[model samples]
Every structure is written in C-alpha cells, then in structure tokens.
Target: MTLSFDGTVIVPAADPDDGERTAEALVPHLTPTSSVIIVNVIEKAGGAPDKASMEQREKHAEDIFERTRRPLQSTDAALETDILYGTDIVERIFAEAQDRTADAVVFAPREGNRLAELLTGDVARRLVKEASVPVVALPQRDV
Candidate 1:
C-alpha cells in the first residue's frame, strides 16, 4: 500500500541529529500539500527538578528544529516547530497528534542498544505499539 503524506503529520524528534535524519527520510514522502509538525518533547521530572533549565531546553529544541528544517526546506510541504512538556515522552507525542488531528506520527528510529532501550522504556517501541494514529518509522539513510 502506498502511504500518502497529504495531511498533517506529527513528528517527534529527540535531538538535533534525530530531527535532521527524520526530516531527511520524510522529505521524499511528502507532497506539496503535506503539513509537518516537528516536535521536541522536554521530559519533565514529575515534581522533581528538571535535568536542565527550561530556557536551556527551549534553546536545544530550537536547535533541533533548525537542523530538521534544512532538508525539508527543499520540499513544498508546510513545516512547523513545536516544544512539548511531559513526564512521559510518548504520551506527550500522542496528545499532540490527537490535538492536531494528525494523519500520522512519523519518525526515524534513533540508534540504541537493547540494554539502553530496556532501561529507558523503549520509546520507539511504545510509539509504534500504542499509537492511536498511524506510526511510520522511515528508514534512515546510511551516514
């Protein structure tokens, strides 16, 4: 089945590198009518002190958006950036998708080992398995 990127897509990116790579992978799939919402979720500590200050985290999110926008600039797709806050990253992403009425949640899975994924609760796996909307893991190009 051919996947169409005609409507709004929610893209959750963890970092600058992931954002850039995901954008690159998604570029080929998007059409002139596609709307891309590239998001960075600032994980809260759930009442505890955050790992980084809000200002710093916001700056980092901006960096992610900047890099992500590079490859996407070549496409005619509408691009937007967002910063979200939540204790659970996957939940925040899903909430955004629902709020935006996104057609799909698209991303390029970040590289990690089994142990790391297990320790971190494997967000990529959860995103795919527990999605209310379609989740597309675009294949990453070799560096």
Candidate 2:
C-alpha cells in the first residue's frame, strides 16, 4: 500500500543527527502542500532533579530543528518545529499528533542493539503498537 504525505505529519527526533536523517528520509515522500511538524521531546525527570537545565535542552532542540529544516527546505512542505516535554516520549509524540489532528506520525527508526532497546523501553516498537493515527516508518537511506 502507498502512503501519502499530503497532510499534517508529526515527526519526533531524538537529536540533531536523527533529525537530519529522518528529515532526509521523509523528503522523498512529501507533497508540495504537506505540513511537517518536527518535534524534539525533552524527557523530563518527573519530580526528580532535572538532568540538564531547561535552557540547555531548549537550545539543543533548536539545533535539532535547524538541522532538520535544511533537508525539507527543498520541498514546498510547510515546516514547523516544537519542543515537547514529558516523561514518556511516545506519549508526548502521540499527544502532539492528536493535538494537531495529524494525518500520520512519520519517522526513521534509530539504530540500536536489542539490549539497548530493551533498556531504553524501545520507543520505535511502542510508536507502532500504540499509535492513535497512521504511523509510517520510513526506511533509512544509506549514507
């Protein structure tokens, strides 16, 4: 089945590199009228002491957006960026998708080992299993 990227899509990036890669992978699938909302989730420490200052995290998120924006500049897609905060990454992403009435949540799976995925709660798996809308996993192109 073919997937269309003609409506709002929620893209959650882990970091600058991931943002760029995911954006690159998604570019080929986008239409001129697509609305791409790229987001970076700052996984808050709940009530515990934070890992980094909020300012630092926000700056990092901006960096991610900058890198992500480069690839999509070639397309006519309306690009936007947001910084999301939550303890659960997947939940935050789905929340954004719901809030935006997104047509799809698209991403390129990050590479990791089984042990790492298990330790980190395997967000990629959860994204697919718990999606509220169409979830698209774009194949990562070889660098």
Candidate 3:
C-alpha cells in the first residue's frame, strides 16, 4: 500500500548534518509509489527573533535541504520538504507525522532514550514510544 513516510532530521550543533542515512537504514520504506516528506525542525527563538536571525535560520535549513536533497531526489519515490519551528522536536515530529497522515515515521538515533532503554534523551526512543504509526529507528551501528 502506498503511504507517506516521515523523515525528520535534526542536528543540535550549528552544522547541518542530516539524520538521513541512519533513518533510512532503520526503515525499509519509501517505495516508488509512496510519497516522502523530508522535514527539518528548527527551534525558533520561541517568541521573536530578529528578522535577520530568522532569515539566517531558514537559510540554514535550506542549506541542509540542499545538502541533504541529493539522496531523496535520487530515490525513485517523489519527495517534498518542510521547515517547522518547535520547542521540542520529538513532540513536533510525532505531531507532524500524524498530521501528514504518514503511515510510518523514520528517524536516526539520538542520545535520548528512557533510562531503561540503555539509550540515553534520544529522539529515536521517543519516536518509538509516541509515534502512532510504525517508527523505524536505526541505532548507531557501524555497518
């Protein structure tokens, strides 16, 4: 069945490192008939940032898209992009996944996880916990 897959990538540092390769490794998704939405979450100042700052952040995300777009574009499936502001990305990722009617959500491993998971504050753990649709989380396993 055709479905939308949510591939949300977030990097804590200033660099625009993508969570794509890891996210893809976790989930065998994105068929040619399936639609994929590539999302990047930027933490807004929460209130107001100077227009310049906002523009810079958007540009940063755009830069990430440009850098990250190759793999998605090279894939057989059609892909789209989105930029969103969220104080808490884990929450936003799940919300967006549901809002977009994604049949499944794929994410790269983060350092946050329940103390029990032996993983530690990782988005991957949260996605597995909260995602309504099936969530695929690839750990940092060297292949």
Candidate 4:
C-alpha cells in the first residue's frame, strides 16, 4: 500500500527546536500535496495567568510560528500554524489533528527528567499511544 501523510507537527514553546527537527524528518516523506500544520500549545495549567496575558502569549506563539515556517516552506508543502491554550495539551493536539483531517502527527521526542515527566505527564509518549492518526516522532540524535 502506498503511504501518505497530511500531518500536524506538534511542538511546545519550551522546545521549539522540535518543530524544526520534525520538519526535517518530514522532508523525505512528504508529497507536494501534503498539508503541514505546526502547532504550539500555550499550556496554562491554571486559569488566567497573572503575568503574561493571552494576547502576549499569542503574539509570542505567532513569532515562533514565523520562524518555524521557513524550514517547512523549503519542501513545497502547504503549511499552517495553530496556537492553542489549555492544560490538556495532548487533547488539544489530538483535536487539531482530527479537525485538520491529518493522516499523521509528527513530533520530535523530548527527553526530560522523571520529575518533569511526572509534572508535565509525558505528552509525547501519550500522544504516540493515544492518537487516532499515526504519530511519527523523529528519532533522537546528538547535536
């Protein structure tokens, strides 16, 4: 069977490099018709941040998307950006993938300490296992 992907590339603001790495991984697999949506979840574990407002967060996410788009643009793929807010990061990501009719979800696996994983709840792992679409995590490589 011929394989194809209309994908969403999921990246967190804390690790924006993941988006760039994911774009690199997708280069060989993507067709000209492939649609790539780059998503960054502005994760707020609590209601209404006292420091940064939603507008500020959105502008920051927009700037991150602006930089992230260049590499994906090199492949001649249709690219879009999505910024979401919530504590349920994985759920929001899955929602976007389904809404976009994505055939796959691409990501760069993040290596975090046990404490951080416990606190943040291993989103990459959960997304890989639970997503309806195929989750393609770019292999971890040394810089």
TM-score of each: 0.95, 0.95, 0.66, 0.79
Colliding residue pairs in candidate 1: none
Expressed as tens digits, the lDDT of each residue in 1-143 for candidate 1 is 76669999998988889999999899889999999999999999999989999999999999999999999999999999999999999999999999999999999998899999999899999999999899999998666
Task: Give the total clashing residue pairs for model 4.
Answer: 0
- Tens digit per residue, CA lDDT, model 2, 1-143: 75569899999998999999999999888899899999999999989999999999999999999999999999999999999999999999999999999999999999899999999899989999998888999998767
Q: Provide the overall lDDT of each model, using Cα atoms, as 2-decimal numbers.
A: 0.93, 0.93, 0.58, 0.70
What candidate 3 gets wrong by more than 4 Å, as runs, is 1-15, 23-28, 45-52, 110-120, 139-143
Quality of model 2 by C-alpha lDDT: 0.93
- Judge candidate 3 against the unseen true structure and give its global Cα lDDT, from 0 to 1: 0.58
Model 3 alpha-carbon miss at residue 75, Å: 2.1
> Every model's Cα RMSD, please?
1.2, 1.2, 5.6, 3.1
Question: In model 1, which regions exceed 4 Å deviation?
Answer: none
Evaluated against the true structure, the overall lDDT of model 4 is 0.70
- Candidate 1 at 52: error in angstroms? 0.8
User: What TM-score does model 4 achieve against the real structure?
Assistant: 0.79
